[model samples]
Target chain A: MKTLLITLTIALASLSALAQGVKVGDKAPDFNLKNVDGKMVALSDYKDAKGAVVIFTCNHCPYAQAYEQRIIDLHKTYAAKGYPVIAINPNDPAVQPQDSYELMQQRAKDKGYSFAYLFDEGQLVYPKYGATKTPHVYLIQKRGADFMVEYIGTIDDNYKDAAAVKEKYLADAIDALIKGDKPTLVNTKAIGCSIKVKK
Target chain B: MKRFVIYMLLVAAVAASCTRGERPTGELAVPIVDYSGLEPYLNKSNDTTYIVNFWATWCTPCVEELPYLEKLSREYSNGPVKVLLVNLDFPKYYDSRLLPFLKEHDITAQVIMLDDSDTNTWINKISPEWQGSIPATVIYRGTKRQFFERAFTYEELVEIVEEF
Candidate 1:
């Protein structure tokens, strides 16, 4: 019984740690979520790809809205090259009505998004990735059967003006991965709206 | 009696001027300042605890938490705390959005515009734990500081300030 108690304690401790989600160099976790097109999509669906640009963004956030065109352009530029932009709206609709699945679908159609925009329903996927804010980017590259968290944080240095962006962090990371090399600048941060999770 | 009437009129005019100082009339000029003008406010060597809140006009949670910050500033008016609302609104939106929002809310805390876009380098300089999210706040007394990246209730905000 004493040994059982110790084993249980260790199990709970590890569970709490896993709850904090993935970090750099860690194996990226996979999820089967519904896309804006009413079809189910998963990271495995992009099995043929070299890497993935998993972006947590929402329709309501001004920061996310500002990057919409940039994100669309990223998908257009990289989808044919094996690294595609996988947009995810991690915000709970109950908390932010504008980020609801219906609105997400509308935004995807209206914006002419060429990539898979998934909805993290029941608020499951984001916390597993430890996503803190909208417009947060996690670049994952597949190695063997597992995808590794190569880079985490923002898309670029500037969110206000895409033309003014000096450092394209996401594009740079993807380019390096394509060349079988590590990114020169791995991680970055930018002022973004906090992910609207349900209370 | 004539001298007394003149003195009362002078006092009334001086009182009106003081109120004007708190809030300027006509088109209010929102000072657009860079990090140089802001460094002094953050690096004060005095005993006052500075509660610096980073916010933008478009950020929902930031706007939601603004009231709590405003309230805390008022409650701690005579105390050792000073609240500074650093507006991170885009320079283009300063006249169109930010200034109008400030005027509409009648925000009492000291507000200033931060125009720098090199956030990746400076975010860590502000706080290592900051994820560069709005509604983030830094409470500091001299060099000792604490940074919170999430929204805070009035009670939660006061709890932190009172602890310092």
Candidate 2:
């Protein structure tokens, strides 16, 4: 009985810790989430690419709105260079109606989004990635058939004005990776709207 | 009687002018500060429990929970609880968005605007557990501090403050 109780306690502790989600150097989880185009997109679909710039964002967040153009610019600049931005909407539509799939399709069409705007139906993908807010970024690199999380955080230092940005953290990390060097900064933080979910 | 009437008129004119002078210009002034300026509020060594909420005008959850914070402030006004709302709205929207929201919501709690662009540094300093999400709160009484990365209801807030 004593041994069983100890095992149960450890298991519960680790389960709670797992709720925090993935970290740097961990193998990134792949999902077949539905895209705005009605096709299912998966990380494995980008097997030929060097890495993927995965960003959790939605339509209603002001912070996400601020970075929308920047995200488009990132895909424009880096997609050809082998890192494509895979945008995901991880909010439950019931919690936030504006982030519903129909609006997501409309927003993508209106904005002319250059990348896949996938919806994490049932809200599964973000919890594995430990995404707490919209505009959270996770840069994953392909390493011997495994996608390893290289960097996790925001797009840059200045979310409000991209022109006035001093530190391009995401760009710098991608640049270092292309040059076959480790990123000096592996993680960062920025204020964003919390990922909406129902109780 | 004529002298008395003249003196009364002069007094009324002076009173009206003073009232006009004291009237607010309709422009709400919220102090803007960097992370350095905000650090002192987070680390006060006093007996009063300070509930510092990091929020913005645009964040939905933050806006949704503002009334609870206001209620908490109102209930604890004469007590040792001090609620400080730290707003993170963009500087460009200060006039266009933030002020209007503040006015519309009738937020009477002490508000301070945080204008720092270096979020990576200050975010960790606020709390390592915070992953840079708004609607996050820090309730502290001197060195005994608790950080919440989620929104709170009035009852939950009251329970926490009571314990503090």
Candidate 3:
């Protein structure tokens, strides 16, 4: 009986590691990445809210910086409606000093960002989400027994010039989920700086 | 009481570790992903056409152009044409970041992590007329190598591959 318990414990540990990251059908990886305010936030903590929008973002990267105001606008528009936006910075600070935790805190404060700007320590959370871009967006939902990814892609249709945005991909997803409808687009072709995952 | 104590300890440990947040995340400690081994092909090789492309992690145009090269590599599966995708991404970024990006893109070409930091040594080795901008493609056939610095649509990629 003791041997069986030991084997079960080991098996459970490995399973947990493998399943710790997010996938299409799997429950989104619950995390405690620190926000810009030095506060810790978890995906589970946002559970009672309608849904969550986690964006892998950074302080630098022209593409990300370009979308900064829109991201803030998104938080203002969605946080009150349940699908609050939670931004995660994945850039390594050793390579890009601009992305350091302190800078992240400073940038968040400067930008007046109302959302959770969390950090993915050692970049341990990026691969699970398969996040590749600075502005990679993920829409998460919980219907019955599990949490699942609702959408992933660019913040919108325009990047070179924000004034040219024709389709608001993120806004549409949040609006759909809020109205009790399945998001029309789940996966989109992304364009931005490739996420710089740290070791 | 004992079980509750164990559970509390587990949660505390997890919370402590998870709260550390993102460490400096640009480049990471990666296996030396050097392209020196493939230098011969670029320097003294006699392949009819050598298609060399420069790419990096932060460039969107580079990613957009990759699949075209991948498709070309597959279509010319029975040919002698060589497509070498030289990633200019720093080594640290290669291990921690580029691999995941490649995996996401479904890239299937002869993708190589070119360890060329000193731009002086390599910038001239590839071509004197070349500027180190991404989405730049060079097609070499025997003594000839043609370079293009723009995204290739499907038809354009096929034409370039055929010409090479």
Best by DockQ: 2
For each candidate in turn, the TM-score is 0.86, 0.88, 0.54
- Stretches of candidate 3 exceeding 4 Å from the true structure: A1-23, A144-146, B1-164
User: Which runs in model 2 stand beyond 4 Å of their true positions?
Assistant: A1-19, B1-28
> What lDDT, from 0 to 1, does candidate 3 have?
0.72
TM-score of chain A of each: 0.90, 0.93, 0.84
lDDT of 3 by residue, A1-199 (tens): 9999999999999788565545555567767888877788988777677778889889877668878999898888888888788899987887677889999999999989889999887887887876755787888886654457888766776554568777777799888888888778665543356555432
Number of the candidate with higher lDDT, 1 or 3:
1
Q: What lDDT tens digits, residue by residue, belong to model 1 across residues B1-164? A: 99999999999999997865454555446666767767777888988989999998888888889998888888898887899999998888876788779889888889989887788887888888898778888889987988888889999988888888
Q: Please tell me which predicted candidate would have the highest TM-score against the true structure.
A: 2
| Ranking of candidates on DockQ, top first | 2, 1, 3
* Pairs of residues at least 3 apart in sequence or in different chains that clash in candidate 2: none
Give Cα distance to truth, residue A34, candidate 3, Å. 1.2
- DockQ of each model against the real complex? 0.61, 0.68, 0.03
Instruction: For residues A77-148, write the lDDT of model 2, one tens digit per residue.
Output: 999988999999999999999999999999999999989999999998999999999999999999988899
Q: What does candidate 1's lDDT look like per residue over A21-118, in tens digits? A: 78889988899999998999999888899889999998998888888999999989988888899999998888899999999999999989889999
Tell me the TM-score of candidate 1's A chain: 0.90
Instruction: For each candidate, give the interface RMSD after superposing the true interface residues on Cα.
Output: 1.1, 0.8, 12.9
Candidate 3 per-residue lDDT over residues B58-85, each given as its tens digit: 6656776788788777777667766778
